[model samples]
Target: MNKRLLSLLICLCLFISVFAGCSDEDTKKETEETTNEITSETSGKTEPVVERGTLKSFGIVPDDYVSFSAKMFDILGLDTKEDIYVYNVPQEAKVIYIEAYSFDGSGWKNVWDSGAGITAPSHMSGEIAIEIKKDYSLKISGDYFSSTTKPLTLSENIENVTVLKLDDFWEFELDKEVPVYMILADEEKNEFSYNLEDYPSTENLDGVDIAQVLTIEFSSEPL
Candidate 1:
């Protein structure tokens, strides 16, 4: 009877040991699976989302009746010109600076620097700057004539006029016959518009004498 009882106890001990080992393996597997899941989720949350294929346009007029010339250059110093100049920037370009220069009858003088926020000189060359990562367009008008004494006629008999206010210290002359082409920002629409009727507030600009509309387009991605 003693030997039989001892044999039974030994068998029970063996069964318990096997069962404990299996439980330990299952627990370890579960813990490893949970750790992997957490790691994947954290990686997904930390990754940044990049914006691509976006278009932005701007309309700009100089403060005075000075001739305005605008050229876009990339890191490699390549430049182009047109009514609406288009440029493709390299990947190396991280920041773009817009600057304006005035001609003192001899040489070009730096008038406005966008990076420094310098107030434009009384005689601005109608140069402006903007910082952006995606593609952009600069619509220019009244840049052909440079005579400070004379104001160029941008448009005549423009109907449905709506004036937009600008923060920059620019002046305009209101004429019923001649219409000014202004670069007005419409935040609600999320795009640039040529029509002045879209904006009614003319508190910033009083009168303007500008030229025909010109546009310059810039792209960060390859064409």
Candidate 2:
């Protein structure tokens, strides 16, 4: 009887050891799976991937460099003495988007956008520019007009238009004091004019009723 009881106890002990080992392995596997799930969830919340494109494709050139903060200007080796002017802007304009680019030795690289973080080399090849877009709503004489204006294209000689966002409005800080023309179009009349002064004072049927030219002036303050 004693031998039989000892044999039974030894078998029970072996069974319990096998079951405990299986439980430990299952617990460890569950913990690893939980950790992996958390890691995947965290990775899903990472920053968005920035888009890459060429400067020419986006119609950006070195002369399009506008004034950033004073620190950014210093970093890009820009001449701060030139007057910056954004011409032909509407009476009320708000910047809706901004795109930044940097030039390395070989080519111009899109470095940043308005909401994304900037990515660039430690040193650039002295070329940088920012493209700004503003809201198209025009308010005139306590009335609002819904008009579509064509995209602005800067001339090769026209430069030094630094746009900054200040209190929900776009502010132009001029460096070279150049005249920048904002070409506006009247879709209803199917006419576009850059120089309103060129037209005669005589009243005509096809006169521009919606477009007006505005020149913004700013003090020589460091951005």
Candidate 3:
């Protein structure tokens, strides 16, 4: 073969190799971006979606009320507020309380409690003003007098008690003497009275699917 022809062929091959290398790099970059997108969606880190500019109004709902978890503010890239108001609480509920806490080096430190100012009866509207500093955690709680009940105490007879399941035909055993009056509420928030002293252990819930038990209280006091 001619030397010139041979040299020309070698240069062409080198050019093709370079072109193939560039294409592979581009393909690899595209694949990486696609993978990242999938990962973000699956991992619950997708871009936040809001209804119009509603959330942009700082969740200050008008006739209707909206509540924001602390993380919601962070996701929106807004400056943390020193105070926030909760609106549109259920009318049936008697008390609305907001708690603010700051995370210390070790644990959460209670910073503010709305209960100090907002009391029952007059504050039944469920609207509350919570004072919080930047980087503080906030929690809102409301209680309806009718729905308020006590948490049943663990009977000593049942040494090993575990909340096997919630609101289901869960399995639990009773055997011990309870000093405090026990209260149990069903799924519909209907109260059921149980006292080991009055009721016999043989009170057969045999066929009953222990499910639908919303809460059980040992003492009559609300928890």
Task: Summarize candidate 3's per-residue lDDT along 1-223 as a digit string, tens digits.
Answer: 6999999999999999999999999999999999988898788522322343233221122112234454476468665432233232223333223332322334334444343222344442333222222222222233322122222333334232212111111111121211111122233323333332332232432222121122121111112
Candidate 2 per-residue lDDT over residues 1-223, each given as its tens digit:
9999999999999999999999999999999999988997987533221123112121112222332454366578776432222122221222212223222333324443222111222111112222224442211110111122233344444323323211111223332121122223332534343243332222332333332222223223322
User: Best TM-score goes to which candidate?
Assistant: 3
Model 3 CA lDDT for position 180: 17
Candidates, ranked, TM-score = 3, 2, 1
Spell out the clash pairs found in candidate 2. 70-223, 82-175, 82-176, 83-174, 83-175, 83-176, 83-177, 84-174, 84-175
Candidates' lDDT values, in order? 0.32, 0.33, 0.33
Once model 1 is optimally superposed onto the true structure by TM-score, how far is the C-alpha of residue 113 displaced, in angstroms?
Answer: 30
Kindly give the stretch of ten consecutive residues in candidate 1 with the minimal lDDT sum.
Answer: 169-178
The predictions' CA RMSDs to the true structure, in order, are 20.1, 20.6, 17.5
TM values, all candidates: 0.22, 0.23, 0.27
* Candidate 3 to truth, TM: 0.27
Better-scoring candidate (TM-score), 1 or 3: 3
